[model samples]
Target: MSILYVDHEINNLNSFKATFRRDAEIYLAESTEEGLKILGENKIDVIFADHQMPDMTGLEFLTLASNQYPSSIRVLLTGNAYTDEFKRAAGKGYFHSYVNKPWDEQQLRKLMISNLR
Candidate 1:
């Protein structure tokens, strides 16, 4: 499965790539625009976006993505424990799930594997 990860921090992006590179085809983007571009060009199966981006919030990007590519599973990653925001997004059908910034690698891997299936 192909997965796209969008984050402003290079290190975070790098870490994600390193963590999941062996598991799937990984695409990395540093901005929403870049992520959108990648989405347009690739058949992404899943997408994970950092919530606190500089230009657009991850939910905003995921909302656009949901309209453009509804089949791709969306996931939000946030540093803050904003359950209300996460719940609202999920209720709106913008994202399938939300992950904390310092996420458990095993749980995330499992989530990705299950969603891809």
Candidate 2:
């Protein structure tokens, strides 16, 4: 399976990649623009985007990506608690999952594989 993860924090990007690289084909990006480019060039099975980003919030990017790649599962990650934005995204079917920051690797891995299945 292919996983696309976008985070504005370079350290988070690196850490995520390090944790999950062995699981599948992993694509990492430090911005929404780079994430979009990766999505364009790849047939991603899953996507993870940070809630707060520079160019646009993860909500915006994932919503757009969901429109363009309906088959891919989209997940939003955030350091803050769930808010109205998440409720809207999930209600609209733009988000398949919402994960809090400092995610548990085992749970996340299970989430990814389950989504693929």
Candidate 3:
């Protein structure tokens, strides 16, 4: 399976790729636009976006992605506590799930693996 992870932080992107690269084909992007570009060229099984980004929020990025790649499992990564917006987004099926930033590598790998199956 292949995964696309979008984050503004270079360290976060590097860490994610380092953690999950062994489990799946990992693609990293620093912006929503770049993520979209990667999406256009790849067949991604999962999409994970950081909630707060310089260009667009994760929700906005996932919204656009869902419109184009409805089958890809969408996940949001945020450092903040779960808020009403997240609740609403979850209810509306904007994303498949979320992960808190500073994610536990093993748990996140499991989540990614489980969704692919």
Candidate 4:
């Protein structure tokens, strides 16, 4: 499956590629605009986005993506402790799941596999 990860941090994007490159076809973007462009050019099966970004929140990006690519599963990666915001976004059906920053790789892999199935 093809997965897209959107984050402003270069290190996080690199680390995600290192971790998941063997598992799936991974695409990385540093901004929501770049991510949207990638989405337009590719058939992404899953999307993982950081909650906080310079231009827009991950939720906003995901909301836009969900509107355009309803088949792609969306996930939020957040380091913050704000469960309320996460819950609100999830409740609105913007994303399928939220993974805390510094996430467990195994758990994330499992989640992705299950969703893909």
Candidate 5:
């Protein structure tokens, strides 16, 4: 499975690679435009984006991804707490799940495995 992860932090990209290097083909993008460029060239199975990116909000990215890459599973990872309003807002897009930052590694692994299956 191919996964695309977008984040402004280089450490996060490196950490993701270190954590899931063997599980999937991972591609890292620092900006949404770059992510889309990679998407145009590869068959991405899933996409995870940081909500607070400098280029665009994760919600906006997912909204665009909904139209451009509808089949890719979209996941938003943020440090903010969940609110019904936020969930309702994201409902219009293709986001499959939301995870808070300081993410639980085990839970993330399980979520990815189940979704990829």
Candidate 6:
């Protein structure tokens, strides 16, 4: 399965690519527009986005992506503590999961594997 990861910080994208490169086909996007383009061109199974992007909030990006690619699982990664609104949005189906920044690689891998099945 393929996965798409979006982050304005190129370093973050590179790090994720390095970490998961062997596990799956990884596509990295530096902007929301690029992320959308990648999604349009690819058969992505999951999307992981940073919540504090410069151009758009993770929720906004996830919401748009979810609408266009309804079956692709979405995840939001944020350093900030979870808020009530985030909980509400997630409850409403904006994203499948919310992960803290400095994520546990093993857990994420397990989640991805489970979703792929």
Q: Write the per-residue lDDT of candidate 5 for residues 13-116, one digit (tens) a residue.
A: 89998899898899999898898899999999899988888878877888788789988888888898876755885777668889898677787788788887
TM-score of each: 0.95, 0.96, 0.95, 0.95, 0.92, 0.95
Per-candidate RMSD, Å: 0.9, 0.9, 1.0, 1.0, 1.4, 0.9
Give the TM-score comparing model 4 with the true structure, all chains together: 0.95
**Number of backbone collisions per candidate:** 0, 0, 0, 0, 0, 0
* Model 1: CA > 4 A from native: none
Off by over 4 Å in 3: none
Stretches of candidate 2 exceeding 4 Å from the true structure: none
Off by over 4 Å in 4: none
Q: In candidate 5, which residue ranges exceed 4 Å CA deviation? A: none
Which residue pairs of candidate 6 clash? none
Pairs that clash in candidate 4 = none
lDDT of 3 by residue, 1-117 (tens): 999999999999999898887788999999999999999999999999999999899989998888899999999999989999888978877898889988888778778878888
The better candidate by lDDT, 1 or 5, is 1
Judged by TM-score relative to the true structure, which candidate is superior, 2 or 5? 2
Candidate 1 global lDDT: 0.93
Candidate 3: clashing pairs of residues:
none
What is the C-alpha lDDT profile of model 6 across 1-117, one tens digit per residue? Answer: 899999998878888999999988999999888999999999999999999988889889999988899899999999999999899889888899988988888879988988778
The list of candidate 6 runs beyond 4 A from truth reads: none
The candidate, 3 or 5, that scores higher on lDDT is 3
| Residues 1-116, model 4: lDDT tens digits | 99999999999999999999999999999999999999999999999999898999999999999899999999999898767877887888889998998888998999899999
